[model samples]
Target: MTENEREIVRRITDVLEKMASGRKPSRIEYTETDAPDDSTLMELEAKVVELNNLYAESYRFILDLARGKLNGDPPPHNNFVTPFKQLQSELRHLTWQIEQIAAGDLDQMVYFSGDFSRAINQMIDDLREREELRQQLADSNHAKDKLFSIIAHDLRNPFNAIVGFSEMMVQMVNMASPADLKQFAEMIHTSAKQTYNLLLNLLEWSRVQTGRIDVKPMEGDLALLIRTNVNISSITAEPKQIQIYYDGGDSYPVTTDAAIFNTILRNLISNAIKYTPERGEIRISVDTNNRFYYISVHDTGMGMSEEDVQKLFRLDVIHTTNGTNQEKGTGLGLILCKEFVTMLGGDIYVESEKGKGSTFTFSIPK
Candidate 1:
């Protein structure tokens, strides 16, 4: 073969070798016309030999063509380069697949026939998991923002009343008569009680959110606890002529938190006293089954619709209703009652009609 023909064959064979090797061909250095320096040429030959080993397993025909071109050997009789050409096409396809995956296209599920494909697929799966976790965290933050927003807006009214009423009563005491002073004192006491109850509920609810209200089971008399709270709350009820009664004389005892038991009674009795008209009646009763110790407080007062009962215990919301004698309610007592009852392994439920009355029933394990 002539020198020009040999050079052409070498260039074509170089392209074929790169196609089989699954790598881009480096720029060819073809300036020397004479046989190259033995040492430098031998180094290049060693590299080609290393490639030849890979080509023997992957593309023997391409390696044979490259060697034949370098030696100025005759071309193949049939000129068939079909199999090597197909290998080059597959290499181009793999390069495009890598570029697509890098550009955020992970929909293609690469078959794990080789180590290279498996490594790339694993990387894609890791990226997808991180993206999903990021989205979930963003959603959680959004929900927290909404909760705090509701809490801030709803808490403002009760706080304003407590502060305003406290300051006003202090100023009025100096100029008032004994009778007027007594009324003012009562107003101040009621406002202070409301403020204190609000704070207590807020603290308890925070504890509940932090998983602190663990129910320590103990035995206690449910009826006696109810009667004691009713007696204590009677001072507030008497002035308005609200009569309180207990339907069950039986001293039923149950395993629960006694402190929370007192809190539930105080809140319910207070609510009954606040909402009932003068000369109205409130009733207390205890009933039990195999599974539960049920206590109920029923009042013939200004009752609520289904909607008001539904929102009764929500901490991030505020609701209020006026007493018959224009008594103010901060709405925190019912929320506190609900939380305390729940902590004692109990559930609270309410039943009411708009015009007739309201009943709050709670049950704890017997």
Candidate 2:
């Protein structure tokens, strides 16, 4: 029934009808037959069929791309190729750009000209800002965790000792000998003093954390600060027979916060006395250049290993160690000292040998 009407126009119309219904053409042997009278119509129909095949191939590549299959070389966009291959190339480039950003290269930018390029560039910028904020939050959380650990473990110990010793004196004073009474009282005094000092430093650290401490820098005498600390330290040093030495010229001034300078000196000297054996020595000295003042506290005491020195200033590490004569410390003093020194635009450092001694030094900008 179809042999009489198998003209080129009818054949192309049948092909379009099949494609329009989302169907494939049936396989059939086409025998040579009389061509259409309109030669130009047959040529146009042949080109249309070729274009249809071309578009189908591109659709396959595009379908894979839609599913995130960005690998492998694709056919080049040629004369027969429309915007599909161009899209494939763009997607492949976009895939690489995304990989670079995930690898921490936030500077990558897309240069394609369109809404997609602009959107991608904006997304990269947003990611960069968020990455910076994420880092700051991580640092703050780490500081908080370190402070909590010290409070929960180290601060509790000294307070417990003070309460226990004081309670013992109250309950046993009548039955205790005069010597036992004096020893128990001395123990209570030592524990209370240590606890009080730790509390003061902890309060100051809290102030720093809450952004309450405004740094007010002024010119002040570094020597006088050292002298004041030396006098205060001597009261505790004398009890252990530890000799304190001070070396600095009069009126050696620097631009700094007096309170912060005083805090650094007090903590350093206090640490020295805690670690020194009976009859050991501590020396405080000062040196300076045009732009900065350097203060040092050197001690003839039980020294530290390299690892211990490294851990001393880290809040995340287990840093607490018993001082000589079983003196208790919260490790907060050095942490506070470092924070204060840094606020005044200075850096504190420690030099020590395992069996020798430790010299804590700091340089403050003048």
Candidate 3:
């Protein structure tokens, strides 16, 4: 064949090889090595340039996908390039799939049929779990903020009352009658008691929140525990002419933490006294079923609305009410009671209507 014909044959052979292998062909470096005419050489040069351009576009497309830049510009869209065109189409689909996942659509599944798909799905699951935990922590932090506010309010009121009453006494002790002195003293004593109870509940609740309160249950007499707390609580109740009764019979036995049980019972009885009218009656009773020991404190007091009952024992939504005689309440006692009761493997509830009365009930294992 002539030199010109040989050059044409060589270029044709190169094109066929590239098509067969489905690989991008590099630039054809045709120069004056044999000096074919300029026009024939230019034709071969254009084909080579086209092939190089196809590979360049394909390279840029893969690079963009790797860098996670899914916006702007696409790959070479020519159908003559088999694998490059196919890859560009698939990458567009992958981008849409990822966008769906980003927009809170976990149900948008990817079925790429390989380890790659499995890895992507696992990543989605991890992201979802992290979001859920983040939300829970936020809610917990919000509740803690409310708790601190209640503490500040409870502490400030009693201290101010004590200080004011003491100041009045210091100034008027010489001129005041015995009746005035005794009244001031009693006021001081009441403020001190409210402050002390708040501190106790605060300390115990802090320990429970930090997961440091350990429960050690033992075989014990429930009747004796109720009687002991009732005696101690009567100190507060006697002043209001309230009568406290406990008929928890001779030997009601249960397995429980004595200290926690005592605190729970004391808080309920104290609350009943606070809400009950003067000369009212509060009866403590104990009953049992096959699974648990049920204890209740029933009172004929000024009860509460259902809305107010729902607000009790929640740190985030606290609504503390004063006693019937305008007595102060710290709001921490019931929260501590709830936590302690839960720790003792029991549940506590109250049945009260606005005009009627209330009965606080709790149950623990036998």
Candidate 4:
């Protein structure tokens, strides 16, 4: 080799050694005066520089990916970067799935290979189970609170009235007129009746919560059931002169749980009588579709606001108001009605406007 050839070979060896030692190598420039052997060395130097440039590009891309920077310039489309491009695509898709999971979509799943896929899928399943348990806990707590409220306040109030009126009656028996004695007896009877009804509802609600009540559907006369409930409710309505009008024929057939149906009707009729003013009217009507029977109990009474109507039949909220004669309530009856209706394969709803009357409608499979 000539002196120029040796010099070119030495420079290329230095660059190669630096690159091998993990250091940035100095660039080798082409010269004007070169032998054939020097030209071959220069070509070898150009190949080395090209390889180093490609290495640097790949290194930067890998570093960015390691740092979780997904928006950086992508690596060149070569054999060296093919695996990295696939990894980046997977990471982008994983980011979207994580976002969806955070936004309450627990249906997301990762299908990547190995431990990462197993861990992520397990995490999603655990989150969904935890959310369902949380909702159930909330419902249970609401039910507990409602039960305590009724027992502490509603149950106690009627007992107090019963005790006080009976005591007054015993003390006034000798000196009081027949009319005054009759009034006291009536007051005591009303309080006792209220207590009885509250206890019945409390027992029913407890059974419902414990899943003890079973539905027994049998063919029965719907008109006769309505007449019985209305006749029973009239005793309470007579005092206020509020009339109940039901004109269904002698017999209308339905397949339903008779006890549940009776309870629902009794509650609706009693609620109407409680809310209706003196001389107001209550109308019971029934309509039928091919699949269901729609029973409507409409009352001319002081109605509710849109907001108050929305609060009905929810255990989380307690809504109650005094009747026309200052009768007290715990709002449990409506909740029981909702539960029983649902149990009987029916849905109940109400429509009311402020100052106008309310119509409560429930549907039963015919």
Candidate 5:
């Protein structure tokens, strides 16, 4: 464009600015008569070109800024709902898997393949191992039931014969000479007593295995229980010349299952008598502290070694050794004692050396 045209446009803008400021220009500035020099014309043209470039760049910048702002905004709520719903569903699925495992469904599996997946797989493996262990326990119990059943059925014959034949033998002995009758009666009595004791142990063990027995805990006199057991066992102890003694501290009252406790006391005392040598003495004692009572039965008997002591209370090991007096036991009595003691929240342990005396200590809550 020529200098004239450039001036006209500039004048036009000045007029508009003055009008916007609410002021009128002193005079009109437009002119078609003055012709600019060559240098002035080129300068005017450069100014026009600069203004056009500035406006075009500014418009492009504003358009790009608007587009950027739109991109920075968050997605629509509807667009987010699906993924959010998916996350909630996954959490619910995990919670259900945990519940199933807690409820003992060992076979259930969680379909996850992350760090949590490894832990879930480990838990399932542990449950499977536990189930296998439970099955093994059931099989062992079944075998025990079968063995006890056989023992129970087989026991009747000897018991019946001993009772029946002994009564007739007594009649025959009474008819015999005085000296002969005394020996026969004594033999019959001894045999009957042995059979009775065996039956008692057998029945008690069976009751314990079947979970039929209920232990009733109460305050009891331990000293009385010991003395009574010693007296009852003397019949078996006397012939072996094994003197049974109760050296327990004064009347000790302990909280325990009375009937079961009595059984434990009787069995231990009789077992001591059964195992001890001639002239050996068995001492029973009760020691007490602040929280518990310790009842120990010590015997100068053919004591067991470490191996026998280890397997002593296990039903499967069957550690049965004949007493010095040839007295026999089913090896169930000690196992029953341990079971009953555990049920009463008590424990039994033995300390012994071969040929040395054995001490069996049991503790009950006071």
Candidate 6:
């Protein structure tokens, strides 16, 4: 064409070639001249300059995105950079989701299509499962520590008492008075019984932890079971003059695992006798709702505070206290009662006030 058109064509070709080669193109400029094609050439040159500027902006924006500089200035609104802007928005959202996940929100999920989405969701699920297992392991370790503490402290005390008192009795058998001999014998007996109860509870608790205990339920006389436990517990209670009163008329029928029921009753009765003062009273009573039998062991004993009661069933806390007669406890009996009650498809609760009394009630399905 003419010189002006030829110059315009050359500039446009150079700009297009630079852009095609992924290089920033220089700004296009055209001077106004008194030629017939000047206006059209100038117009074309303006379009070329605009295209070069757009290409430079797009290239910078894409470079920032590639470098993970998500907080930089966003691309201008244009058809050419629309997909990049959308990608930036998605990436910002993903960053926020990742931050939330890092802050312990495992529920965050990525929904973008492709392997990234699947990988992120899978990571969240794995983190949640790992957290659950970590919590379980911590609880298991705490339980083990509590058991070891009881065995080391509580079990050792009773055995020491038994051994010390029996040895004293043997050494003084020929020289000691009848009253002293009887006293030593009684001490040994008390310590032996305590040791036996602790050992039995430890065994049963271990069975429970191992998932080896089975519930064997049968229909039987509930009152007889209560009376039996009360009778056995009375051997200890009579010394403190703590009277146990159970008047279930000898024929309270119920369905339960008889062995578990007996163990629960034995512990409750023993606890009551242990804590109740001389001349105090223990009342065993049963009430029935439409679906369950509620058995209560109410005792006029040195009761616990609200805080101590709250600590009673938690494995992470050991809440033992001396009985009214300075009787030592491992605080394991109530824990066992709770476990056995739960195994029998029941729940146990306690109501007590400091220095007033405590009532332990458990429900069994009728």
Prediction RMSDs, each to the true structure: 12.8, 6.0, 8.4, 4.4, 17.3, 4.0
Please, what are the lDDT tens digits per residue for candidate 5 over residues 62-100? 344335422222223433234434544565677788788
Clashes of 6: 0
Query: lDDT of each prediction vs. the true structure?
Result: 0.70, 0.80, 0.80, 0.86, 0.72, 0.86
For model 5, the stretches where C-alpha displacement exceeds 4 angstroms are: 1-181
Q: Which candidate, 4 or 5, would have the higher lDDT against the true structure?
A: 4
Q: Select the stronger candidate by TM-score from 2 and 6.
A: 6
Cα lDDT, model 2, residue 157: 81
TM-score of 5: 0.60
Top lDDT prediction, candidate number: 6
Model 3, residue 144: C-alpha shift (Å): 3.4
Ranked by lDDT from best down, the candidates are 6, 4, 2, 3, 5, 1
lDDT of 6 by residue, 1-366 (tens): 788688778877888888889665444454444464667777877787787776676777778898998876755665667788888889999999999999999989898878999999999999999999999899889889989999899999988998898889889999999999999988988889888988999999899888899998898988888888888888778989989999556577788899999888888999988889999999999888788888999999998899999998888898899999899998888988999999999999999988988999998886
The candidate that wins on TM-score is 4
Better of 2 and 6 by lDDT: 6
- Give the Å error, residue 191, model 3: 0.2
Candidate 4 on 244-338: residue-level lDDT in tens? 99956677789899899989998988888888899999999988889888899999998899999999999999889989888889899999999
Would you list the rank order by TM-score, best first? 4, 6, 2, 3, 5, 1
Residue-level lDDT of model 2, residues 187-245, one tens digit each, is 87887887788789989989987889888888777788788889989998998899999
* 241: Cα error in model 3, Å: 1.5
2 against 5, candidate with superior lDDT: 2
- Tens-place lDDT per residue, model 3, 198-296, is 788778887887888999999999888898888898988998999999977888878899999998999999999999999998999998899888899
Candidate 6 clashes between residue pairs 3 or more apart in a chain or in different chains: none
User: Any idea what lDDT model 6 has?
Assistant: 0.86
Error of 1 at 74 (Å): 50
